[model samples]
Target: MIRGVRGAITVENNIEAEILSATESLFKEMIKANKIKAVDVASVFLSVTDDINAAFPAKVIRMQEDWTYVPVMCMKEIAVPQALEKCIRIMMHWNTELRQDEIQHTYLEKAIQLRPDLTKQ
Candidate 1:
């Protein structure tokens, strides 16, 4: 059976390093929680809030992972009133045998507040 894992992280700053770090952490957490190998990921889609336009999160992931095979895309999220800023969200379509409840979703920093029920202890 295949499962999808969703994760998100917020960068406190718009700098390239900050964006990369937050994204890297989010990916690590997602992979760890879902027990997914890079090859198990069918595709990964990332969306950044309108405030983040300096760099593509997918490009950063490819560079950091040095994986030429996994597909990744980045897009801009709709800017709503009082929406969270500097946020990067990821939805990973994974080909795995894991059950639905076994799939772990990660929400970090400000993004955690967006889904307290999922992120809170």
Candidate 2:
């Protein structure tokens, strides 16, 4: 079966370094919480709020040796009114036996408010 794991994080600023750092932290936490292997990831879709344009979160993740072979894409989040600012989000298409309900979703920093229901699961 294929499952999708989601994750999001907030960056304090729109700086490139901040975006990259927050993305790395968010990805690390998501991986740790779900116990997922890089080899199992089919592809990753990353998006950032309109306010964030200093860097592409997916590019930062692709720097990992294991991720070089993984397909990744970065896009701009729809600019909805009252949407979270400086937030980066990721959805990983994983080839795994885990059921959809068993997949762990992660939300870190201020982004936790985005999906409180999934944070603890």
Candidate 3:
């Protein structure tokens, strides 16, 4: 089955280093929480707030040791009024046998407020 694991993190600035660091951290957490392997990932879709334009979050995934072949796409998130800023959201399509409810989602840094419920898990 194909399952989508969600994760999000907030970066301190639009600098490329900061964006890449935060994205790498978030990606690691998501992989650890869901016990995901790069080979099992079908694809990844990453979206960032309009304020973040220094770098593409997908670059972090490609840097992983065995993730070079994992399909990844990055785009700007919708500019919602009063929504969180400097946030990077990820939706990873994974091939797994786990049920929907068994999947784990990660929300970190200031992005924790986006899904308070899942953060507690």
Candidate 4:
């Protein structure tokens, strides 16, 4: 079966180092929470708010030792009115046996407000 693990984090600034660091942290947390393996990841899609243009989140994944072959894409999030800012969101498509409800999603920093229901208090 295939599953989608979602995660998001807010960057402190629109700088390359901050973006990459935040993305790496979010990706690590998501994979750790769900016990995901690099081989099982089909693809990853990252979306960042318009204010974030300093770097591409996919670069973080590509830098991982075992994630070289894993496909990754990055795009700009829709400019929704009143939406979150300086946010980086990721959707990882994984091949796993776990049921949809059993998958763990990660939300960190100010991005936690985006999905209060999924995030632990």
List model 1 lDDT by residue over 1-121, tens digit each. Answer: 5677889999978888788888988998887776678877788899999889777788766875545688889888888989988999999999987777767789998898887877746
Q: lDDT by residue for model 3 over 10-52, one digit each (tens)? A: 9988999999999999999999888899999999999999999
lDDT of each: 0.84, 0.90, 0.94, 0.94
List RMSD in Å for every model shown.
1.5, 1.2, 0.9, 0.7
Tell me each candidate's TM-score: 0.91, 0.95, 0.97, 0.98
TM-score of 1: 0.91
RMSD of 4: 0.7
Q: Model 4: how far is 103 from its true place, Å?
A: 0.6
Clashes found in each candidate (C-alpha, N, C closer than 3 A) = 0, 0, 0, 0
Question: Which residue pairs come into collision in candidate 3?
Answer: none
40: Cα error in model 1, Å: 1.0
- Model 4 / residue 34 / CA error / Å: 0.9
Query: Which model scores highest in TM-score?
Result: 4
Q: Candidate 1: lDDT of 112?
A: 86
**Who is ahead in TM-score, 2 or 3?**
3
Measured on C-alpha atoms, candidate 2 has an lDDT of: 0.90
